[model samples]
Structure formats: structure tokens, C-alpha cells
Target chain A: DTAVSQTPKYLVTQMGNDKSIKCEQNLGHDTMYWYKQDSKKFLKIMFSYNNKELIINETVPNRFSPKSPDKAHLNLHINSLELGDSAVYFCASSQAGGGSTQYFGPGTRLTVL
Target chain B: SQQGEEDPQALSIQEGENATMNCSYKTSINNLQWYRQNSGRGLVHLILIRSNEREKHSGRLRVTLDTSKKSSSLLITASRAADTASYFCATVPTSGGYQKVTFGTGTKLQVIP
Candidate 1:
């Protein structure tokens, strides 16, 4: 079984549309994260959740919101998406806090036309 | 500015040779991690070295951390075509709980036969 799983491996939608990417990790990890990789392949952290508590929400636009229904499930909802929002979104999970290694999902390719 | 920037945006090496990549960060970190991405897939954790440690090894990979210079290096021994992928360095901030991991741009490695 995949330790960390993400749904909608590919998402291609028009601008202004709202979409949600679902992530789940069965590793019993306490921390989950959402990352965005731009065309330049620069990976940036968008949000982090620990036991369903909002931790780090980077300077992302208001259109992007992360909802953690529970410790195992973390979803990202982007409203009124723009063309600039096109990128690869990754979901990751880690067992302990800061010094540990992270396990990543396959990622969802979100293309806003 | 990005927290970690990898040097030699890309590298090509012959089979059986060794490949080296460097990463530099601007802030203090509690630990450094190395991950490998194969093609368009999610990243896989390779190794991690704490701030107090200088070197670590796993399988054919060797990671060196220099906290004084705020830099790190990943060395792959006996490179093979199977090792072709992108290598990234992630920094776990010293002050933040392990959730604040920031990834570098990555170094693309192509193992030539």
C-alpha cells in the first residue's frame, strides 16, 4: 500500500474554477504538508498541518486554502484559480517534528488555463 | 530568496563514476535532508544529517553537512543509469518544529552509458 496517497494525479481546469486535491497518509504520521513546484521546478511549502492544527501557512494567496479533516486526511482547495497557479502540488507526511525525513505522494499536476 | 539553492543546475556523468552536488542555505537549520525524484514522480527520501553531524552514509549515497558555511553536499558512488534523476536538498529550520522544511531547486543528474 502507498504510505502517502494523493488523488487526481492530473488536473486541468480553466481559470476562475475551484478545485480540491485530496491527500491521505496511512503511516500514522503526525505532520502533513502541501507543497507547490513551479515550472522552474522550485519547490515551495504552502501549508503544514500537525494533528489537524494549522501550523505554517505560507504567503500564498487567499484563494488557496488547506483543510485537514483529520490527522490522516489533508486536502487543498483553490478557489478562483488563475493561470499562474499552474504547477505540481505535492503532499507529504512525517512522523516526528523538524529533524525527521518526509514521505511524499506522487503529486497532482494542476494546470489552470 | 529561496532557502536552499543547489549548484550545477544539471549534471551528466558516465556510468561507474561518482556524482557530486552541493546545496547552500541562507538560514540556520536543525537538519538537512536529501531526496530523489524520478522523472515526473513524487520525491523519495534518501538521507538526512543533523546540524550537529558532519557526515552520513546510506547505501551508495554520502551526505556531508557544513553548518559553519551553511552548505551541504550529496555524493553518489558508482553511478548508474538507474541513478538518473533530480536530487534535492531540504532544510529543516532550527527554530521551527521539523514542519518548516524548505526544499532546494534540485540538481538534475543524467547518468550516461
Candidate 2:
């Protein structure tokens, strides 16, 4: 079974458009995270949710927002997308504790033209 | 500034050879973890070693940690072509919440068969 899954594997939209990526995990994890990987392969954490509560919010632009409706799902929405937003976004989940192993989704390749 | 930095950004090796990647972090950490990302895929957890531990072994993978130097290394023995992927080291800081981890610049390994 796929432990972590993401929808809309690819997304291409014009500048200023809005898009959303969905993530779900069946591992029964309590913490979910959203990460952005640039063309240089530098991965940065954007947001994290624990038990549907916002736990970590990095220095990301306000145009990007993360929402977790339940412990099993976390979604990312970007507004006024720009060319710089063209990158891969990953969703991850892990148990709520220190030194927990994280499972990641397939990732969404978003292209802002 | 990134919390973790990896050296030898890329490496190419023949199949059956061992590959090693090193990571250095700037701060105190509770534990260090290694992850692998295949092309066009998300990250996969490989192994983790706590600050108090010196080394760990799993399958053909071996990991070593040096808290005094604030560095870590990952060694994959007898690498196969399937092992060609990007390797990343993530550190969980000792100061703050545990769910947040700082990822290093990835090392892309090319294993030729």
C-alpha cells in the first residue's frame, strides 16, 4: 500500500493564477509537513501540522498557505503564482515525537509559466 | 544560511562500488537522518542516528555520527544501478520542537552498471 500519496502529480498554470496540491497519508501519523524543492535541489520546509494544529511555519511568503483538514490530510494552496514558484512540492508525515521517521508523498511538480 | 551542508555535491561510481556522502551542520542536534530521493520522486527515509550514538548499520547501508564535530556520514556498500539517486541529510535541532528538521544540500549519486 502507498503510505503517502499526492494528487495532481503535475500542474502547469499561467502567472498570477492559483493552484492547490493535495496530500494524504495512511500511516496514521500525527504530524504532516510541506516542503519545497527548488531547481537546485535545495529542499526547504514551508509548513508543518501536528494533529491538525499548525506547528511549524517557516519564512515562506504569504501567498502560500497550508491547510490540514484532518490528521490524515494536508493540502497546499498558492495564490498569485510567479515564475519562481516553478518547483516540486512534497508532503510528508511522521509520528508526533522526536526522532520519528518521515514518509513522503510522490511530490507535485508545479510549473508557473 | 542552511543548517546542513553536504560536500561532494555529486558523485559517479561503477556498480558494486561503495558510495559515501558527508554532511556538516552548524548547530547542536538531537538526531541526524539520511534520506534518498529518486528522480521524479519524493524523499525516502534511509537511516537515523542519534547524537549519543556513534554509528549504525542497516542492510548495506551504514551511518556514523560525530556530535563533537557536528557532522555525519552515510555509506552505501556494494551500490547497484538502482542506488543512483540523491542523498540528503536532515538534522533535528536540539533547541526546538522535534518535528522540524533542517535538510542539507543533496548529493546526487550516479551508479553506472
* lDDT over C-alpha atoms for residue B1 of model 1: 62
Q: Per-candidate interface C-alpha RMSD?
A: 1.6, 1.6
Q: Compose the digit string of candidate 1's lDDT tens values, residues A24-96.
A: 9999999999999998888998998999999888899999999999999999999999999999999999997
What DockQ do the predictions score, one after another? 0.77, 0.74
For B50-91, candidate 2 gives per-residue lDDT tens digits of: 889999999999999999899999999999999999999999
Measured by DockQ, the strongest candidate is 1
Which docking band does candidate 2 fall into? medium
lDDT of 2 at A54: 89
Error of 1 at B51 (Å): 1.1
Where model 2 places Cα greater than 4 Å from the true spot, the runs are none
Residue B2, candidate 1: Cα error in Å is 1.1
C-alpha RMSD of each candidate structure in angstroms: 1.1, 1.1
Among residues 3 or more apart in sequence or in different chains, the pairs in candidate 2 whose N, CA or C atoms overlap within 3 Å are none
Candidate 1 deviant stretches above 4 angstroms: B97-99
Q: Write the per-residue lDDT of candidate 2 for residues A27-96, one digit (tens) a residue.
A: 9999999999999999999998999998888899999999999999999999999999999999999987
